[model samples]
Target: MSMLVFFFVPAVIFLTVVAPIWLILHYWTRSRQNKGLSDEERQTLEDALSVAERLEKRVATLETILDAEHPNWRTAREDDYRRGGS
Candidate 1:
């Protein structure tokens, strides 16, 4: 009871006043200081996006091939290799 009594006022003060001010200041500073992507970073990001797009196209092509080769390949979750016959 005494411990609770000692902590209650400080906790209330922190929750009501300190935490809100801290959060506001933190976010405000972050927003103010946002130096968006540098030239190198931007170029790297573009390259990465291009690579990702190419990979996606390749995957689609592979899937298309698999689909044509075996129409039921998508539905077949084969566990034939399992020791206890699944």
Candidate 2:
């Protein structure tokens, strides 16, 4: 019926076109608004950094032992030509 077409045509257009555009724009803006690190993630990163600092000290101790055992042993920076130093 013409009345049915008149009622549903605009609704179908709104659903198919306007609604999708609105949804896409809304999601795009929301994603932009949420771009920064969350507080929990920042805290976790700080913890990881502290763990890394501890590990670095441990690695330095290991490196000292390694150097003592092998007098001619070279670090990655000392022997640029050698492979697999790191």
Candidate 3:
């Protein structure tokens, strides 16, 4: 029984205290070592940026077309706003 106590107490302390602390520190350091955007996240961000650029170009083209078709379009809009015409 004395022999059992000698080994069992330390084993219990190691399992209940030291093991959890070691595991927490191991994972904490591992996560800190690999802190950057993953490949999939980077790809998604790039795709979104490209789509935004395309949409911006489309809007500029449509605005140019509208300006060519209606030279006084902006003044007409202001007059309509003053008269409360929708």
Candidate 4:
């Protein structure tokens, strides 16, 4: 009975306390490791956003030019594109 109690007490304590603490720390560290983008990844994202903004500005300028030169240009081009007349 004493031998059984000794083994069982430690086994229960390990399972109930040590296991949960170990699991929590393991997952916590993993989450910290995965939390942020690397410098290269952040730079790539910034480059993509910059390019997108520039393209948007260019498109807006082109649309303004087209509006000045041909008022119904969008309607006409949209119709042609919809009809597969690119």
Most accurate candidate by lDDT:
4
Listed in order, each prediction's TM-score against the native is 0.52, 0.67, 0.59, 0.68
Q: How would you encode candidate 4's per-residue C-alpha lDDT over 1-86 as one tens digit per residue?
A: 99999999999999999999999999999999989999999999999999999999999999999999999998999999999999
Q: Count the backbone clashes (under 3 Å) in each candidate.
A: 0, 0, 0, 0
Q: Who is ahead in lDDT, 1 or 4?
A: 4
What is the alpha-carbon lDDT of model 4 when measured against the actual structure? 0.98
Give lDDT tens digits, candidate 1, residues 1-86. Answer: 99998999899999999999999999999988776887899999999999999999999999999999988776564544354444
Ranking by TM-score: 4, 2, 3, 1
**Candidate 3 clash figure, as a count:** 0
lDDT of 3 by residue, 1-86 (tens): 99999999999999999999999999999999789888999999999999999999999998899899998888999999999997
Give lDDT per model, in order.
0.89, 0.90, 0.96, 0.98
Candidate 1 stretches greater than 4 Å from native = 1-34, 78-86
- Tell me how far the alpha carbon of residue 77 in candidate 2 is from the true structure, in angstroms, after superposition: 20
